[model samples]
Target: MAHFLSESELSKIESEKGKESVKRAVKSKTADVDNEMRDIREQRARLVEERKKKRPQTTDKRTIAEIHKEKREVQDEIRRIQDSISCDAKIVLPEHEST
Candidate 1:
C-alpha cells in the first residue's frame, strides 16, 4: 500500500527543497564572481606588463608626452578594473521571485 503525505509534511518537504535550490544558486553565483575577479586581475596584470615594456628610453619631448598619455590610459583602465572587483566582492544573492 502507498502512503500519502499530510499537508504539513508536504509543506515541510517543499520548504526544504526550496532551501536546497537557493543554496545551489548561491554557490553558482559565488563561482561566477570568483571567475570574474580572476579575469579582472589577469587583465590588470597584462596592462601593467604592457606599460612596463613600453617605457621610453628617449629624452624627446613628443615621445615622452605620448608615453605619458598611454600610461595614463592604462592607469585609468586599471582603476576601473579595481572598482569592478570591489563591486563584485560585495555581490549578494537576489531574492526569490513569486511565480
Candidate 2:
C-alpha cells in the first residue's frame, strides 16, 4: 500500500538520514582519534618507564630535561586528540533510535 507523505514528513525523513550519515562519520573519526590517543598514551608510558630505568637514584639534568620535554609533547598530543574527540561528542549517535 502506497501512503503519501506530507512535505514536512518527507523533509524530516531526509533530515534524519542526513543526521545518521553525519553520526556515522563522526563515530568513525572518533574511533580513529581514540586509537591515536591510545598510541600516544602507550608511548608516554614507555617514556616514563625508560626514564625510571635510566635514573633510579640521581636525576641527570640533561636527561631529565629531555625526558620532561618529551613527556610534555606527548601530553599535548593527548590533550589535543581528547579535545577533538570531545568536540564531536554531541553527535556520537547510539546504535539505534526509537521513533
Candidate 3:
C-alpha cells in the first residue's frame, strides 16, 4: 500500500512550501537591490574625493546636485531591499499556533 499524508500533515506541508517560495523570491530581489546600492555608493564616494582634491573653493552646483541624486537613489535602493526581505526568519508551523 502507498503511504499518504493525513489532512493536517498535507496542509502543513503546503504551508511550508508557500513560505519557502516567498523567502526565495524576497532574497533574489534583495540581492539585486543591494548590488545596485553598493555601486551607486562607491561612485558617489569617488566623486566626493575627487571634488575635495581638485576644487577647494570653486563649487559646481550641477556636480553637487548629481551627487545628491545618486545618494538619494542609493537610499531608495536600500529601502527597497529592506522591504523585499523583511519577512520573519523564525517560522512557526500553523498547526502549533493554538498552543
Cα-based TM-score, every candidate? 0.41, 0.39, 0.35
Give per-residue CA lDDT, model 2, range 1-99, as digits (tens): 123445785566558778676566556656777787888899999999999999759777999999999999999999999998876664575435423
Question: Weakest 10 consecutive residues, lDDT, candidate 3?
Answer: 87-96
Residue 69 lDDT, candidate 3, scale 0-100 = 100
Per-candidate clashes come to 0, 0, 0
lDDT of 1 by residue, 37-83 (tens): 88889999999999989987658899889999999999999999999
- Give the total clashing residue pairs for model 2: 0
Runs in model 2 deviating more than 4 A are: 1-17, 59-99
Q: Using lDDT as the measure, which candidate wins?
A: 2
lDDT of 3 at 71: 100
Per-model root-mean-square deviation over C-alphas: 33.8, 36.9, 38.3
Question: How far is 22's C-alpha from truth in model 3 (Å)?
Answer: 2.3
User: Per TM-score, what order, best first?
Assistant: 1, 2, 3
